[model samples]
Target: MKLEDIPRLSLGFLPTPIEKLERLSTDLGISLSVKRDDFTGFGGGGNKVRKLEYLMADAVAQGVKVLITTGGHQSNHARMTAAAARKFGMKPILVLRGNRPDMYQGNLLLDHLFGAEIDFLDPDAYFTEINPRMAHHAAEAEARGEKAYIIPLGGASALGAMGYVNAVKELAEQYAAAGTATPDYIVAPVGSGGTLAGLHVGCAMFMPKTEVIGIAVTGSAVPFSERIAVMANAAAELLDYDRRWTADEIRIENDYIGPGYSIPSEAGNAAIKLAGNKEGVLLDPVYTGKAFAGIMGCVKAGSIAKGSSVLFIHCGGSPALYPFAGLLTSDLKEDQAG
Candidate 1:
């Protein structure tokens, strides 16, 4: 499918700034920069807007009256999809996996504000398990005479994966315009793997010289790499591009996913503080923070050598910080005194 054929809502602030993190670069002894997709124009901004452009297109094509998707309690994808569904005059239903907390915050709050109907499922409900459940819900909607669209978690479908592939093309142009050497490495957090997969194929087909790295925020490298390979191959097949890349072609670094997914790590927190202090950038705890730590570790370990440029894709989730504000504060008393 040609990218131009996809239906995309005007969601993100396009051509997000690509800035050189000179302070961080100097501190880490490597040339580090950022592709600020965080500024993607909308509610708190996130990478989901990119994927939704295509997914929503399909939804509209199918005459969908409602869009259904699944995610964790504080899923940026669910929040953004809710907002997109509203913008497109469709209702959005979110199936939230994980333990249901008493308090609502972060992306969950945004989901509420957007008026998205949410079903908090059992903690043991995995993504695969939630798939049929979502289908059932969509089917129910259809039975009631409503057309519904079921978007997979992270919008990992071939159409949704095209977003990152298109983003690669955009990044390539950005690199050319910046007049810097092409990125030696491109880094992103691997959750559902769609973003990583898109970047893998996009970089391979467009920016052949660049190496794509996936930092697993959840799961192991073996499965994440395999998922990315599968999605990239599927995406390529959809585009009718007869090209293939091995697991070696796409690198996965697992040093920073400390503890588990959505759980904070010392290195991740330090990396978050460093980016904010040095570059005035905000990275969420779950995705970008861990991915940034991986990039930092790779530089420190000589995996990314000195003088080589590395581009960290800031898949935005700044909203996730609000719910975890308690984690960010050193002292509540200090706040009151101030």
Candidate 2:
């Protein structure tokens, strides 16, 4: 199927600017730029907005009345899915994996403001019973004669991956308009791996010469490259795209996930401060901060060659900084000094 034939909704600001991080570029002795998906301009703005454009469009086509999805307490995907549901005149139901916090803040707070019906599950139950739980909700909604569209965790389905595939096409146009070829590297954080999968397929289709480097920000039971390959290959099959991605083909920098998902790491926090100070870019602890840290590490270790152009795909989770304020304020090196 042609990419244009795929159903998609206009849910985000298109073709986000690619700007050079002048200060950081000079400091690292490389051409460092950022693809600002952060400015997507929807539901607090993030790359998830791109995925939802396809997922929500599918929901509307199927006459879905309730949008259901699962994620961690601070899930940006859940928050944006809820916003998309409301915008499309459908109900939003979030089956979140974690205890309900005393104070709803960050994406959770916005989930409330979007009027999503939130159901919390303990970590153990979340891993083992999430499908059954979501099924139960779907059954209940069906009983009431309403159809529910259950988006996977992080909306990491093939259809959702199409969002980034299209994004890369847009990116190629931007690069062409600027009178240059694709950058040497395209970097982003890998959590549930939707964005990574999308980048794989998108680069294969549009930016064939470009390399995608995904920094793992969360430890998962399955190897991230394997998971990304599954999503990327599925997305490619949808378009009948000749290139098929394998686990070996999916490039993931696995050293940066930290202790686990959502826990702020030392390098990640430092990168957060550096981005803010150097380029006025606000990155969240969970994703982009860790990604930036990987870039810093690569530069320091001479893995990313000097003078090469690198583009950081800023996925944007700044709202998370509020909840991790204490850590964000503390100097990681100073805590060690004390």
Candidate 3:
């Protein structure tokens, strides 16, 4: 289906800014820009807002009375979905992974503030076996005569992935207006792979010259690449596009993942500090921080050629940093030294 065919709701401050990162770029010896999808205009502003526009539109069009989604403990997707549901006057019920901790922080706090009903699963069962629980929750909701739609992690569905396709198109338009060459590389953190897949196809369709780099914030490069290919094909078919994406079309960097999903890396924390101190940019421990770390690694390794323009898609998870505030703020470089 074409973009026009998808039901969409306005959730973000559209055409998010593509601004030059002169300080960071100069320090790294490259021309770097940022696609500030972080400022997506709701609940601390995140990439999820873009995906939810289409997802919520579909929900509303289907006469959905309640929305359900699954995500990690401090899930940006869950928070954004709750906010969007509130926006449309629909109830949001989030089935988050892991146990509900005593102290609600980050997205969980936002969930409560937004009046979303949240249920947590037993740790062992949740981590190792969440799919069945999520399915069961949907079934229960259906049995209760309430309309419920289950959104996957990170809102990574074909309809949701269309957000990034539209994003690339927006970025290309911004470049054309500014008379700059399309970005040499477009980098983002990958969790469920939809964003990268969408970008893979979007760049191919619109900005063919740009390379899309996915920093694996969770999984390994192998499965991440495979999943991206799978999703890209699905997205292409959804849009009825003639072109198909190959594995080579997607590039993934695994160096920044370091430990595991939601775990912080030293490099990632440092990168977060650098961006905050130098450019006033905020990236959380989960996604954008890891991605920024990868971007820095690319610079240090000369993978991002000197003077070549690179665009880092700030896919937003700033609120999640609340839970890891101590971790993120620790050992930060002294801003005064610079």
Best by lDDT: 2
Tens-digit lDDT track for model 1 on 218-280? 774347767778888898988888887666666788778898888878888888888888889
What lDDT score belongs to each candidate, Candidate 1 first?
0.84, 0.90, 0.85
- Winner by TM-score: 2
Model 2 / residue 149 / CA error / Å: 0.6
Worst 10 residues of 2 by lDDT: 326-335
Q: In angstroms, give how far residue 303 of model 1 lies from its true place.
A: 1.4
Error of 2 at 189 (Å): 0.8
Predicted structure 1, TM vs. truth: 0.94
Residue-wise C-alpha lDDT for candidate 3, range 1-338, written one tens digit per residue: 77767778887998889878999988999888899998888766888887888888889888887788877788888898988888888788888877879899988999999999888876557656667766777788789897878888888888888989888888888889989789888999998888888898789889999988999988743588777888888888999998876776678888889788888888888888899999998888889888999999988898878888899999888888899977765545555455
Which tens-of-lDDT digit does each residue in 153-236 have in candidate 2? 888989998888988999999999999879999998888888888888898888988899989988778998899999898898
Task: State TM-scores per candidate.
Answer: 0.94, 0.96, 0.94
Candidate 3 ranges beyond 4 A from true positions: 220-222, 332-338
Report how far residue 177 has shifted in candidate 2, in Å. 0.8
